[model samples]
Target: MKRIAALFPGQASQYKGMGRDFYLQYQSVRDIFNRASEVIDKDVYSICQDEKMLQRTEYAQIGIMVLCIAIFDVVKREIESPIQFFAGHSIGEYAALTCSECLNFEDAVKLVQIRGTVMGKFGGEGKFAMANMGSASNDVIMEECIRFSDDIDFVSLSCDNSKEQKIVAGSSKAVKRLVEGTEDLFHGKVINNLGAFHTNYMLEAQKEFNETLCHAKFHEMKKVVFSNVTGRPYFDETQVYPLLGRQMVKTVKWRQTMDYLKKMNIDEYWEVGPGCVLTNILKREDPSINVKSADKILKMEGTGNEKIC
Candidate 1:
């Protein structure tokens, strides 16, 4: 028996027509889009199909969530293997929670809608931006960030995607200054966005999101779920809400989460959302690990046994 871990993709993974194939083939997937539309009061299917509408942060977040869950639903119907662990990146975490039965689909949809609205509103108030630092060690990035913090308004390490790929977020001026000063050390590129997420810059958004989470109900996890903030499996239901609140203003410990999963001796890994972002990260981390995308798995001749890793 193989122990399977499912990874969900977050923001930056959305693309036009992400779930169109799944939506057309499965009524269950179409029903998910319908429910999402009713809850968010937006035609999610149309938004996902249109490249322009999918670019807006608020719309993109909800659209990604709907598509992720829909893809997971279709995969679940086809595969009977029991998932040993569920984890997602950023917004994808809600989909993991839904998979673990920690949150209902309707509630998850509404919460993400509120989360997207709050983040979009508060995120654009400043000249915030995010940048990816390639071919750099975590310690080096952290050291540079700290060194520049004395002069920069807000400079902090955001996502530790892998050993060689890290992200930084802060005010645009601060990020630009840091990048210019350290240009010789590593390859860097600024991501297009208004808000610096997973840093103190999102304090206001975190507070507002906490209020919304207070009303949201969470159930006991049916399967082990890892936290992007803590990079560990949640011990109990009590840790869910607070960790999620803090996740908005904390660095995503993705590399650490991957390390933890490897330590657990997980036999197989599955990327259950749009794009191959998480899957590619996992492959780079360890080529020997067995991994596959659910979308490709669905297209195979029979219950797909081929592994991409």
Candidate 2:
């Protein structure tokens, strides 16, 4: 039997037309979107269909998670293989939890709405994220963090795309300084994110989230799901609430998470979100393992190659 893996995308993978196909093709998917709209009090369907909605972080957050979950639901109903393990990047962890049945759909949507509100309140404009820096040791990254700590306040290591590649985050000014300072160290690229995340700057938001999660209820997971904060399996439903609260303030260990999946003997990695960001990372880390993205899978029309719709 194939050891299938499910991947979820984080904030950046969202787009205007992401879930429209699913909404048009399946009633179940349409119902999920409708439910999200009611719980979040936002028109998620319009948000997913409109380019203007992409500008708002709160709407984008809910949009990405809903799309990710909706896509996973579709794939689960269609695929016959038994899923071995589940994981998600950053915010995608919540999506994995919903998939694993650790959190109910309505609660997850409400939590994410609250999460987006708190995150926005604490992390204002001028905060940013950067991507595509060559992999340096934690010490090396820390040293750079220290040099710019006056301004940058290093937040988190977003993703470990490969042994030689990783993404860094900080405030916009500080990130700019780091990029200017390390131009010689990194020859690749440093693309910025929508805002500052996975850093101490978001502590206030985390505090609010801690209170919110403390009172929330979680169900025992039906399948093993990994945490972005710990890069380990979620053993108890109680621990999930706190882990999420601390996740914003902690660096994401994407490399370690993938390592754990490799240890679990994951035969194939399937990215069940709108984009293939995680799939790209898996390929760079180990190209031999099968990596498939839901977008590619759904777009294929009885052919192995991706098709345009």
Candidate 3:
């Protein structure tokens, strides 16, 4: 038997009508969306259908969580297999927690709603921006950013997605400067969002989010879940809140997380979410790993039921 891990994606994975097929096909999926709507007091179905709503941080966060959870639910119902581990990227962590029964769906939705609002409001206060640096070594990117730090107040690494891909977030002027300075050496593109996440720029939001986490209830994980902050399996449930809080203002150790998974000898990975972002990253990090999007699995197996399992 193969040990399967469930991977969830965070921001930048949401798309208009992302879960519409599942929403229409599965009562379980519809029930999840309905629950999400009741928890957030917003029409999740409509939100997923609207491009503008999918772009707002708050809406996007909740929308993606709901979709990921719905997909997970569908997979659980259809597959007779056991998931050995669960993990998520950034906001996707909430979905991972929910899937592992660490956090209830309603609590996860409400928490992410608050998180998105705080991050967006604080992130928009300044001209902060994020950019993807492709074909650049992490050391080279860091060196360039440091070289320009005198002019920029908040510029740092946001995510180390792979050996060759890194994300930087900071003042738009600083990011643009870095891009222009390294145009000949590396390819870079600005990410669509106002916040410079995983950096000190999110300290204010992190504080508020921590307070929110204090009141949030967490249950013992039923399955091992990796932390983006530590890039390791969470051994202590008590550390969940603090790790989630720190994740806001810390670089996402995604590259390390993938390495950890590889060490675990995970036989396969299922990206249980709206987009194939994490799937692509996993393939880039380790081509030998057997990974597939939940939707892709359904299609390849000729399941005919548009649901993921």
Local distance difference test scores for all models:
0.83, 0.77, 0.84
Model 2 lDDT vs. the true structure? 0.77
Taking the tens digit of each residue's C-alpha lDDT, what string does model 3 give over 246-303? Answer: 9999889888888888888888889998889998887876678798786433443565
The sequence of per-residue lDDT tens digits that candidate 2 reaches over residues 29-143 is 8888999998877788888877767656677788888888887877887777977588888889889889888899998998888887787677784566665568677777667
Cα RMSD of predicted structure 3: 2.3
Off by over 4 Å in 3: 295-309
lDDT of 1 by residue, 87-143 (tens): 899999999998888999999999999888888877773578888888688778888
Model 3, position 196: C-alpha lDDT score: 89
TM-score, per-candidate, Cα-based? 0.92, 0.91, 0.92
Candidate with more favorable, higher lDDT: 1 or 2: 1
For residue 3, give model 2's deviation from the true position in Å.
1.6
Worst 10 residues of 2 by lDDT: 300-309
Clashes of 3: 0
